[model samples]
Target: MSTQPRTAVVIGGGITGLATAALLAREGLEVTVLEKQPETGGRAGSWETGGFRFDTGPSWYLMPEVFDHFFRLLGTSAAEQLQLVKLDPGYRVLFEGQTGPVDIAATREENIALFDSLEPGAGQRLEEYLESSEEVYAMAKKRFLYSTFASFLPLLRPDVLRRGPRLARLLLEPLSSFVAKRFTDPRIRQILGYPAVFLGSSPFTTPSMYHLMSRLDLADGVLYPMGGFHRIVSVIGDLAQAEGARVITGAEVTSIRTEVSGRKTRATGVQYRSPDGTLESLDADLVVSAADLHHTETELLPLELQTYPEKYWQRRVPGPGGLLLHLGVQGTLPQLQHHTLLFTEDWKANFEKIFGKDTSVPDPASLYVCRPSATDPDAAPEGHENLFVLVPVPSDPSLGAGGIDGAGDPRIEKMADAVIAQISSWAGIPDLAERIIIRRTVGPQDFVTDLNSWRGTLLGPAHILKQSAFFRGSNASRKVDGLLYAGGSTLPGIGLPMCLISAELILKRLRGDTGTEALPEPAPWSATADSRPESAGRAAGGDAKPLPAEPSSGDGA
Candidate 1:
């Protein structure tokens, strides 16, 4: 390895890409970020409509310390750079057919009290659950999340081994089972399972270990930036640029070029198609892909250098794609909190229909509503609200299986109206549909077409027993020498914090500090057919066997 300032090319300027580039640059490497959109912040992008601003994607800001750690690495605090306000009642939950709503207060004690009010001894049970979750979080941070694990030894350390039984217990139990075992009240179970939905998996399939998400909220507290999540993208973008990284917006990368033959094959640079239709190639020594892993492997890399077979993707389950409604409303929503979940009575059936049966909207489906104006006045005009509503839908093409037919079809409108009606009745807001100043919707097709997500999957591969941990896409590309993967689709699974950790893991591999042997080439591509078997393919070659089930553990904070 040379000590020279290595040239790095970051594909896709999302949070993961930007964070990776900034971290690498701060380490004295030369970095450049390329984005296809007119601006940065891939899914977290912002837009303006009818004189109002909407965050567009990723409205919730959980785990503020993750952001703080990112900034702290650069000798600054995130709060010092961005104005963050801790939400009092983190968010609200409106259960279907329930009389009153549930609020998650900031402090752990307060949140426990709220649960206690629902059941006789729920407060004590919640505390016990949280303590176990904290242990999971601590172990996950040290063993699995922070560093690269090319082999299983890192996860099999003596300390982790001692905790293995507990972890296995947590993993074997489904989230629904765990929640039910803990609390007698259905409302508490609903609260515990809320974050699992965001992972694109249902509580029935998602492991109970994910309950750490609830502890995270009650312990760390929910927060919001003064402006919006976009402000976060802007600040990180600024920090990356300050570290001498060049961010080129509106530049779409068409392909990645690699040298062949010799053992030390390396990434030369990339071929990009600009907005004006001009094709250009730039040279680089290293490449980190933060875009969709499927697109990067199948499209950007030449077929002669492809990695795993298309069949590998077939066995994996992709989570449901969401149908989003972005609205700039005209009057205040009196009872609406900063965040709310309107749970459908038949939660399990709805999930089964979407994930198992590959169907569309259910008659009474779970809905997540976010009224940013409730927390930050700047998100909307005086007495107005900026509401982002999301409902889970099937990612498959067989439309009308459940209720909706397709995007922009009458079925979509009908479903949206039904959700609006529910909100209207629950909040006692009259003519809620009429107050809309601007409306924008994104469905499964949009996720596939625009974001290039495989099978229109919202997050990445499902967090199933066979797909989690090292089973997920490896951070360092096995096919190409110099190429690395960093995003929601890779190791450590989905979520803002996990994605950031993914980037960090890739960086550690690049620096050769994780004790793994280096690839013979810089960035090697795999040459395999789409129908090839999972075992013994060209690009990042390895047996495609399912990874053994380890323990239930937390992720890096």
Candidate 2:
């Protein structure tokens, strides 16, 4: 091993890779990031068309502390680089057969009241539920979220021992059962349970440890970058370069170079094809892949260097692949809010269609609609609207390409029309189709081809109990020395916040440090006059049903 500064090459230029490159450079390592795309943002990349701008992936902004911590490490903050706006009534939920929509308020009190309106005394119960959730979140951040299985010290910590019993219960119980046991109203159960979908599993299968996402929402609140969520990507990229890290876009890594002596094999660097059609090799002491985990294992490394083979990947439960539509309408949509979740009444069957044996596009699929123009007028042309609609489906390339011979199953056009019709009918925008000036559809095929994602999954692997934390793929490789992994597929799991934490964990592994990094906390947020009590009416959308039977599968963004 060299005593001088080491060089590192990071594959994939998404948030995770960029953050890792920046952190490594700050730690005195020469770092280089290679992205196959023309842009460095990966899924966070944006495009302009028809006088509108669209963020390709990851629109929701939760866990503000994670981003703030990452930026602060680069000697800056998200606030300094990108203006952030706190969303009041963070998002709206439109349930099937409901006259009014459920607006999940940003304030703790409002959320409590929102729960109480659904069932008497539910407000107090929510307070208790969140209090427990807060404890779990705090402990998780200190113990599991920031630390890796690189050491057993985490298991011996006083806090971990103290909370062991409770943590066990959380890990053992399914999120669906946990919420159903606490809240009587079906909507309350649905609201609390829906977040588990973001982790890429059915509420019935995912552990209740994920309830921390609710605290991240109700207590911490949701935020958006002033420009768009993609701005965070650019901000992080700039910070990485400012820290002396070099980022090379349009460079597709072909293989991770390795050397073997006797019984030991070690990764030394990577070989990639440049945009100018030349194959180039870069030497490094270490190589980290923040790209799709499956692609890295199956394609980038030699078969002998591969830790998890094709069969291993085949057995893994992947997160949902998305069916997305980006639209530029000639007129404004008055009925839609900045963030809207339109859920169907047959929630069980809907989920079954995604992760269950049936695994197909749901007939009456639940949808998520993001109208960035509702918050930032610059997103669209004057008097026009920009809408990004997403529907979670099974992660399968065959389904992505509309099945075999392109005629086997739900055709992309048919699916898009169904989604549009659902949105038009639900939002009361009857002429939605006619007003569309620019329309783009992204299916499973897009994910598989564009990002080389496993099964065209929008998110990474599903966070089933078996695929979480210590059980999840390690950030550091087990079979190869000097090779590591990051991103949604790796430990500390999915989403942008998780990606930032993934970077931190990777740092800990590389440095062999057991102590957690002390990043500054997020700025205090509170409800303002606009978030006054009863803003959405005492029972703006108060209605309930009994908890439905647990479904075999579920999916969400």
Candidate 3:
């Protein structure tokens, strides 16, 4: 509100923090991003070892429109900074006892044909499902995803009222129920129901409202960046700095200092440990925490300023943690695709184990295997392959807290070995284990130490009915007047797109711009009907090593 430069300190150099710092700097505020890791990107970060590069967290670029819209806001486009390659068969879903895996194609006709061959009338029904999903995606983008829950007025809007019935059904109806009502085939149901894992819920429990994920993956199709997933991070960081935002990686904010005036307690600055282990402090007019929400509230802010205590978080269900294995093998594994999902025959049992109170990992577990070398040869040395495997594991208090130190835990190594062996058998590579030249594992302990993730959850909180929308953590602090929250833990919830949207929502609230128009404007290229990207090939990886946080680990990949 002042003509002079208002300094703002943003904790965490993750996607949300970087985006927020850029936007705020563009608005003439002096913004500084404080990231604990040596590099930014949080879970979306990447690391390289033994000439093999691996994206630490998210690899699938499902929501292309979201990324494009973000760059457009920076006065540029993704095409300018990143060469995105569209995966023709978006991904492969393999089932136990099946000789051949089902490839989900980018084109509707190909997918329809694949569905029809498996089940009669299923092809047409698949189209119907996606059609409904498309409508839901559009509606959600307008009325929910891009909007914040700062007021109750938006719920009374004309468009929201008009779709009240449809919204109610989707909100109340389970995804499994919705799919079963339409298709009789079990395989068809499994295929349609798989996207629920992306939001950290089982199809049997997740609301049908989340079926919009199908539109993002099946209809819009999945994509890969030119040089692994970290390219997006490098590009965004450049743009943020170009916009006049200063970045200080390896500076971990230990405490958010506050000043009290009358009854108001406002955040004034922060004390952080610099990369060299020296203590330092930075004064600011406002503090935006894009770090782990729990860590920010319980550790960074004082006890009195804490709004959601440990008990508050304990009651809310958290998304799954991950058992990750990054491998550099001696030879190529032609049986695998760039993006592969190995589904369990008894998927519900796997879900039970994940959500169950027991600390046991799932048996015959569902897993996601990402072979970066499948698309980019440079990801590995000649004739070798770089594989990143992820299995959904429990992140309850019973599990070990995730971090670099916990990465070498014997239990984690044992679990990783079992999962890798299972993947080898499924991929028809009997000697896969023998070919592994380099290996690393990340488990619950790694998540806790790296990102200070509550319960070591990779995707923040579970997107259950009670935790959805306004029920989720607030971006604006309830007690700390000048502090705000961002990232997957806060409003709009989970996924990289949601992180970007969270930044925009926080910016609007800070600027007092409280209208539907506050949402991100569509990129000029994205407005076209046939904006499907061409398949471009390139090398993937860099010298950066894995960071503290990991990607969206709860998603069934």
lDDT of each: 0.72, 0.79, 0.78
Number of the top lDDT candidate = 2
Which model is ahead, 1 or 2, in terms of lDDT? 2
Q: In model 1, where do residues sit more than 4 Å from their true spots?
A: 1-5, 397-409, 515-557
> Could you tell me which 10 consecutive residues in candidate 2 have the lowest summed lDDT?
548-557
Clashes of 2: 0
- After best superposition, candidate 1 residue 494: deviation in angstroms? 1.3
Residue lDDT tens for model 2, 324-406: 77788898886887888898888778888888876888878888999999888878999999998888988877755432122
Worst 10 residues of 1 by lDDT: 548-557
For model 1, residues 297-370, the per-residue Cα lDDT tens digits are 88898665666556667777887777777788898886888888888788788888878865666767788888
What TM-score does model 3 achieve against the real structure?
Answer: 0.91
TM-score of every model? 0.88, 0.90, 0.91
lDDT of 2 at 21: 79
Q: Which candidate's TM-score is highest?
A: 3
